[model samples]
Target: MLRNIVEEHFDNDPDVTIAAAKQIRRMDRDYADVGDKLYALQIAKGNRLLDEDDLDGSWGQFDEAGALKPDAPEAPNGKRQVLLAKGWKEMERCYHACPDLAIDALEQIMQIDANFREARSKLYALYVSKADRLGRACDRDGAFPHLMRALEIYPEGGEAQQGLAVCTPTPIPTPPPAAPVQVPTVTPRVVLPTPPPPPPNSPTDISAAPNSPTDPPVVRANASSAAHPAEKSARTGCARAEQSARTGCPVTEDSWRTKLITLAA
Candidate 1:
């Protein structure tokens, strides 16, 4: 009954196991192993709690087991397992929401056991993830340390190498001076010759006077003298007028009247 209680009730009813062990020890000397059985029960309960991810409960069980038998290796080993499980749980829960907390938790796990279940890899991945997130947010300065730490963890990590490359500053090259602009030459304009003025007293230069008694006589050109005797007489009158104008002499009225009457006849 005591063996059954220790084996079955240790996980579900720890108080029942304790009561059974106490009663069995008082009743028979053959059951002198009750104290050792109780120690085993506590260690078993702690391991079960650890497997169920009940960190606080597992820690309490491991502490009670160690108090029961301080020289036992199982209790100390169980306590270490519980701490490792706690660190893993914290890291998983806060990796994205609170990366610093997650890093601290993983680091604690490293202190507990550097070889604990891929803790180094998990820590490296966390740093890389944090660096990537900050880089995406344009916080390169904030991301630098995390990227550097990730590279330290894994010197040959491709993602860490790429991230560091992105963070480094590159110098800009200076541009060459621009070529001078060319100005086009203009052509001179050609000058044309001016035409000569028409000659004075040309046949087209004739002008007529107004028909008035006080007005001077008008001379008209003869198209042809052979056209008629009248035309020949008219030409003679025009010749006499031109002769009077050249000498700057006034013609006698009687002479002009006689010449005009003859041309008219």
Candidate 2:
């Protein structure tokens, strides 16, 4: 208890008990420091358990003494020399049935010292096995945690890296849907055959007013008789064109010819 308290609580006194423990184990190989005579009683109890084929109980007592007496080179039971042996034995006995129970036994060995012989490697392998099983079952969420634990112990392990990738999800790219085909719609143009443009004299044809067939002859005659030809022709020809238009009769070609002869004279 004192050793556990000192190692667990005080940061400075952790190794303080090592020297004293060594001396006690050297003189009293049975561990006089443990409490009255707990070590002796454990040995008796271990012998009785062994007689009953209780290998587990016997191993526990042996291991407890090993912890109490680290430096007892010649101590009958010895210090963890068989550290991995007992866990391996237990794992073998129950591994085919309940792997976790066997794994727990190995983990207890790890608590004593993680690097103890093959315990770390064995524990890491078990984690990989569990990871593979869960991943194969499509339980990635369950698999990843075990893979992470394995990596923590052996960061560069190939099995752990492979298992992690197996458990990881991959995204599939979906192609965009195909574009729909467009059909051409033809609207027939209702070409009401251009209603042959109204005659140039028609009152509705504003576009034809400048070149009215009836106004052009009068315009040419008025232009010849006046000095400011464009201004005078515009005023006189437009007035005659308006009168001819209102009377619904075109100007006589003879009237235009007469105007032209007067201008010449």
Candidate 3:
């Protein structure tokens, strides 16, 4: 009846089954299989708690199961299932509110099971999202590490590739010079010839000579004889007339009168 009670409480009440098994072990020293029965009951209780999402309670039950039978595979497997469930729950709760914590949770899941329920994809997306936010806030230096990590997670991710390109730095360039100016030349002047002066005055120029006060007043003899020629002729005729009268060789009175008239003429 006690063994049947232990078997009946194994699924529904593991604690009752544990108490019944302990009482059976105490009553009959031949009941050596109670230890194995106790281990099974504890593993059953841990699976029940894991299904209820009671990670702490499940961990305690599995720990006790492991202590009962250290070489048991059931306890370790149950603990692993609990850790996976806990990590997934934490990541879902804090992914938007606290992304860093969510990222840590996903990374832990990766260590346990790399392909655990989109963990690698979620981690890659988180890194890319952090990098994008930092880049938009003008913190490219801070964004580089996250972008690099994202690329490491997903080498072929277009978003991560584009982000890395945006975060990288480049160089600048220079300019050219200007040209020169021009000037003109000047010309020379010309010269002319000079003319000659006039000649000097001669001694024949009467206007150049002045009169002397002591010069004698000269008279012309031809001018004086020409002016009295008729008077001298009349005087000569009178002398001839008087000499004829004195001579009186054949002096007729008529001849004497004729001679006088001729002298007068």
Candidate 4:
């Protein structure tokens, strides 16, 4: 009885709706009998809260003691009747006469009376509106979960089932290959000059270089080069040509080989 009274008080006050809903659930499994005055007061207040656009308005007025109530006051049934009329008017304006408020009102009613199918149907429609909105958002993934939840709540609901099918993303298609274009090719008319020979290394300069002191000390020309036959070449620094001593191609002349030996010495 106390719990019912508390919930009724809360239903009359939009600010207390959450607390009222909680207390309403704590009441007797069938709400037992908390007095018709108190029960009807809570139901009417709950209806007003659902109807208000702000969803923050009070469901009922005040008492002689100056105490506020969420639901209608019990001692003055006549005053409660007047308040209920006002609440209904406010609800009608806030809800735009849509059946949406019916679902909210029914939800509260179900807490007091579990076997209320009228409220269940209204709640189901609310779910449909929510699912439809979700499906149209960039995060369509979010809508799928709600749709599944709605299906769980109403397994026979065709809207929920149909929405699930329509929201699936379409598969991407493969495009055909583009035709290839022919590009002009150019032949070289001028040959680049061969690179100059690298400089010779000095024994004293090589010795001053860093290395493990314990390693064998040696100084030698660190030169490297490669050349192909039929190419005219110039000698610079310590370079000498020995025809590559290969079998088939034009070999280095004996005179060039002699000059290379002299440079090494």
Candidate 5:
């Protein structure tokens, strides 16, 4: 009966509500067990503080209720109404990109009533939004805490599930094996120079005729008496005389010749 009076005047008359609370405590043999009534008195005081815009004092009372009965619903002292209104206001903050204030209000609403589904849903959505934005920015590790919080609220939510997947540690791609170190093996190629065409009417070195196919063709000469090569006699007798004299050929003494051939006609 005393409790009913407290509820009716909880927000309207602080004096009357406090008096009613005292009366109820006196009437009950085990008043200490009436935690709900005590909680109501605290909420009434908090509402009075809130009415005066004394947010700090009101917070103390509300927090006390949370410490005592965290799962309790808001009291009849306009506490429920204030929390609901404040929650929406904070949501507006969120829209304006003030996430910190928005999150604080949503959490407060939950402290007032743990079963507030709208607050939970919105809070979960906000957390997921932050996580996704951060993940897209290559902050996957930083994004995980937000997704984890969202999951704690709604374990079955698809958004958080996908966000968790986004935060999952992915295997770094193995770099394409460093392009095999190219050693650039240099093969030593022996280049043989092409032998100059036999001098205009001169015979090629006959000694070179029986050599290997791959060998360079050769020419033999004698130092000329003139600035130019001296022509040799084609006489077979000259060769015989050279053989008798121990020279290899009429033009010889076993010598080879080459020219840039600036003299080519």
Candidate 6:
């Protein structure tokens, strides 16, 4: 009966402990009371050994040889043994920090020896509380991994599961798009009206006008009249005026008036 209780305590190996629990629960509830009492005594001793070892006080069971078996080793210590010591320290802190969680682990360990489990359950709970507190204080992703390993070591470990659930990450949210830019329009330049030309009989001369188109015709007439008086005597002066500007002297329109004044002087 004592052996059966040990098996249930290590329910981490579900298949084996489940089988053992099934068979043991069916036996006479009060039958082998002495064996039940002996199992309780053994668990107390085992819990003391764990306390001496400073192990995370989780529930465990014994093997066929009546020797207690614990879960797997925690993560390896770093080169300087820095990371490993940190993990151990954190687990210890967790066990001490949260009384409720520590109690849960200790109670589960003591389940096999109800009397022993109850007597030392508080201390066992402290161990678990220390481990959980350390994990949370570190605030690292590795904390979850350590907790997961504890669960794997003791598949029935409720405290480890709770730690894992809390340390899990949450998802991020997305945002919306921005507004468009506005541009200004520009206008073109405005042109002023051109003044009208002077009348043919006006005292105001047309040549002084800036960029006037009528200057070339007046200059051509003056040049032809001055150079071809004989052509005018024969009534052929109009044709000679056109030819004079083109061939006679190669004189420019500006020089025409000057040359005529010189001839008169």
lDDT: which candidate is best? Answer: 3
lDDT pick, better of 2 and 6: 2
Model 2 global lDDT (CA atoms, 0 to 1): 0.66
Residue pairs in collision within model 3: none
Global lDDT scores for all candidate models: 0.83, 0.66, 0.84, 0.53, 0.71, 0.48
TM-score of candidate 3 on Cα atoms, chains taken together: 0.57
Q: In candidate 1, which residue ranges exceed 4 Å CA deviation?
A: 1-15, 22-31, 136-141, 168-265
The sequence of per-residue lDDT tens digits that candidate 4 reaches over residues 10-56 is 54553455344445545643454433434454445544544553233
Report the C-alpha lDDT of model 5 over 180-250, residue by residue, as the tens digit.
78789899999999987777755477664576788775555645533333344345346657665785444
TM-score of every candidate: 0.51, 0.39, 0.57, 0.27, 0.37, 0.23
Top TM-score hit = 3
> RMSD, model 3, all Cα superposed?
26.0
Q: Per-residue lDDT for 7 in model 5?
A: 74
lDDT comparison, 1 vs 4, better candidate = 1
Q: lDDT score of model 1?
A: 0.83
Ranking by lDDT: 3, 1, 5, 2, 4, 6
> After best superposition, candidate 2 residue 80: deviation in angstroms?
6.4
CA displacement after TM-score superposition, residue 262 of candidate 2 (Å): 50
TM-score of 1: 0.51
- Expressed as tens digits, the lDDT of each residue in 84-192 for candidate 6 is 2233444345565655554454444444343432334344335445567677687646566556556654667688777877777565666666666666776877988
